[model samples]
Target: MTTSATRQQITGARSIVVKIGSSALTELTTGLDVRRLDALADAIEARMRAGSDVIVVSSGAIGAGIAPLGLKARPKDLATKQAAASVGQLALAHAWNTSFARYDRTVGQVLLTAHDVSLRAHHANAQRTLDRLRSLGAVAIVNENDTVATNEIRFGDNDRLAALVAHLAGADALVLLSDVDGLYDGDPRKGDATLIPEVGGPEDLDGVIAGSGGALGTGGMASKLSAARLAADAGLPVLLAAAADASAALTDASVGTAFAPRPQRLSARKFWVRHAAEATGRLILDDGAIRAVAGARHSLLAAGIVATKGRFYNGDVVDLADQKGQTRARGVVGYDAGEVAQMIGKSTGDLPADFRRPVVHADDLVAL
Candidate 1:
């Protein structure tokens, strides 16, 4: 996909996820910027009236709390950050609700943790909830469950979360509204920097000097690129534009960067296994097993088992490693770790009467 095609795709998108960064949503002197919030709400409401489904993934809880709590800057520790988020989430939702109320539009708040999307059942359920909310003519406002998420397991930024949400909800497009207009050849603050209007895939971002955003936000150009990759892989185009010009970006105007979607779409299970689920264990396979699993794209068998690591249950996603301990694939297992250990090194015919299923089905597997 080229820049022109990406722009065209953005223009045709009927469903979209618009992510607003903290800097774009907050005031330097006050907590929430009511004026900017109103502008964003108006643009979204107009789109809704036009019959487009829109979901907003907004980041500004901490920034919104800064003024009220008298904090000089964003908190450095997780506890303070969580406290700030708890306080600011209320303010943020209230502002959005109030703004949308003027247009007779209702808003619903949804806070999610990384684990929420990692589990297949939870992932599917979340998607259903979001879909129903949209069907009810309410804009679903989402944010990470920062108060409960630990540092090591956090989504880290709303950019990636928004992308994942777009994928989960089966959105047609993703609009990332930030302070910067779009990606550039170099940092836009530099004299020679030039805007790169479109990205087809990961290859296009090579050598591009994408920079970070304001202090209030965790994401930068790099995170947005990662978000675009995730969305594109899930068969959704992405628009990276300035929040100030959000209406133009959402419209047919080419006011920001756009990343075209891949032509192929992965199945819901494969998408969750590849992008959402966390690996719970590792299964080391022999040479023949590696060839069969990677080259032939077949399932793992007990005869090919070399070793196993970590405790895991049936239906859990696990890393399939080669003899060299390198991850070659990931898939949902058919048996628990203990059961797999008992069947290791045994041929299918020699397995116990109870252990008759394939260890990892091909349909459930995804190559790394």
Candidate 2:
């Protein structure tokens, strides 16, 4: 476990990522809640006015569109969900725009799918865009592109998305505004739960009965906990509190469960390679290959590879696994699956001029 941040330090973090869960933003029957939006916008505006840059990851599009689309409750099918998102995203953006207008602040909408952050080029583009948006003094309101994202490609919840965004934008801290006040040792609904004030590492989460959010929401305390750990691992602290306490939480008034960050900061390339890229295939490596790639952190030569499994392209991310079936590293394969298969067990010098290089370059590889 790392040393937790003091209240004063937590309150002073300048770049922050604020995530608002669906349940916090939308009503079950009435749809979009203007009052909640206004209150949230006000808090965010206050933070910005105080010279802090804020990035918002909001989840409420599908939830907000359910009533207007004449659906009884949250949609079940993918098509229905997409339709609702298409309709609701506009309303979500509009509500934010209107709310921010009251405080004379600007908001930028950034919709992303898993693919946006998975591919190297797309990831860089998104990062650059976010940097530019913040440089211009605009708060970015981020959401998943649910209209095109299937379950396989979606982030699963905004909690995880916010963690990734925090890293992407180089945020100093993350605030997860949930329906609950903070993480509890047991189920708070059971009336005997106790709020855990600080989490320095995984050990702090021991014996906590974490659970998902309401049916209308995609994330719950469990997801928020996972997100907090993820951000903490990347050297970004996390504050989990109720949406109603946004002002207090942002001001670092000790209102939420704060997860302290690791002392060492992760490099951007390594962070993206490890967490963002989607592995499309697995490459089995011999002991020597493991020692070279995993132990020494070297590029994967074709001769060290014992075999390859699954279809992957030249630029697709692949997992390098030991014969024992444990993934030791992940990297963008320099050669396609077929190309690597043909070169398996062949020494670099024995291969043709064009086929003599490493299967995955060192720059593209990150030890897991």
- List candidate 2 stretches off by more than 4 Å: 1-9, 352-356
lDDT accuracy of residue 137 in candidate 1: 91
**Structure candidate 1, residue pairs in collision:** none
Query: How many angstroms is residue 335 displaced in model 2 relative to the true structure, after the best TM-score fit?
Result: 2.1
Q: In candidate 2, what are the lDDT values of residues 261-336, reduced to their tens digit?
A: 8898788877887888789999999999999998898989989999999999988889999999999999889988
Enumerate residue pairs that collide in model 2. Answer: 213-220
Q: Clash totals for all models, in order?
A: 0, 1
- Alpha-carbon lDDT of model 2: 0.88
Name the top TM-score candidate.
1
Return the TM-score for each candidate structure: 0.94, 0.92
Residue-level lDDT of model 1, residues 1-368, one tens digit each, is 23387777767777888899998999756889999999999888877777789999999988888788888888889999999898999999999999999988889999999999997788888898899999999999999988898998889899999999998998888999988898887887767887878778778878987666568988988898888788888888888889999888877737878787889877778888888898999999999988988889998889999888999999999999987788988999999999999988889999877787789999999887
